[model samples]
Target: MEVTGRRWLLLHADEPGNCPEPSTTPDDYMGGFCAFNFTSGPAAGKFCWDQQPDYSAFRESSFGHGILEVKNETHALWIWHRNQDLYSTAGDMIYIVRQPERCLVESEVP
Candidate 1:
């Protein structure tokens, strides 16, 4: 269940207040938004939840859902639609940017 080179992680819960501790398993993971900046190494600029506080919109519990469309290697669209909204409407949308040149090590480069 290991995931590598992933810039975004989504956690969805089926029952309200039933979110278990974070795990590799999708059904057991739940948390607010977390961003890790490797620009300064693993220990520096690590585990930041406040960088985009509003990104918490993705952490909605119970019937929360989203879709991710990768436009290319560097850009992708993330759309979160609430249960109350029409399927064509987006409750929240954001662009995910990947900086492989800046984030990946020489050996990890593709």
Candidate 2:
């Protein structure tokens, strides 16, 4: 996601096992995930800024806040906000999930 700045970083990790530490930047962390490339879609295998990240089908630039509702181990809900909206309003939303079986190292059963 092309955020406003470095402070707002949206990263995709295998759950949270490879996420950055609270004290350091995401790219500067000592995580073993080196392949920060698009694995699918039009920009497959390419790095950041080289092309549009097709994995994100829709992206909008809005001035709004966000709410994160962490569900159980497998699911979570992300809700965005805007100042001009109603009390319980959401400018955007995403339902995140962890599917390790789809991210396995080498499973060709598909």
Give the range of the ten consecutive residues with the poorest summed lDDT in model 1.
25-34
Highest TM-score model number: 2
Per-residue lDDT of model 1, residues 1-110, tens digit only: 34557754444443334334333333323322333443453234543222334424465563658999999967899988778766567877899886765545234346
| Runs of candidate 1 exceeding 4 Å displacement | 1-44, 47-62, 105-110
Against the hidden reference, what TM-scores do the models get? 0.44, 0.46
Which regions in candidate 2 have their CA more than 4 angstroms from the true location? 1-39, 43-49, 53-61, 102-110
lDDT agreement with native, every candidate: 0.55, 0.59
Scanning candidate 2 in windows of ten residues, the lowest lDDT window is 28-37
Q: Tell how far residue 80 is off in model 1, in angstroms.
A: 0.5
| 11-46: candidate 2 lDDT, tens digit per residue | 564334443443344343443233433466653553
TM-score of 2: 0.46
Q: After superposition, how far is residue 7 of candidate 1 from its true place, in Å?
A: 33
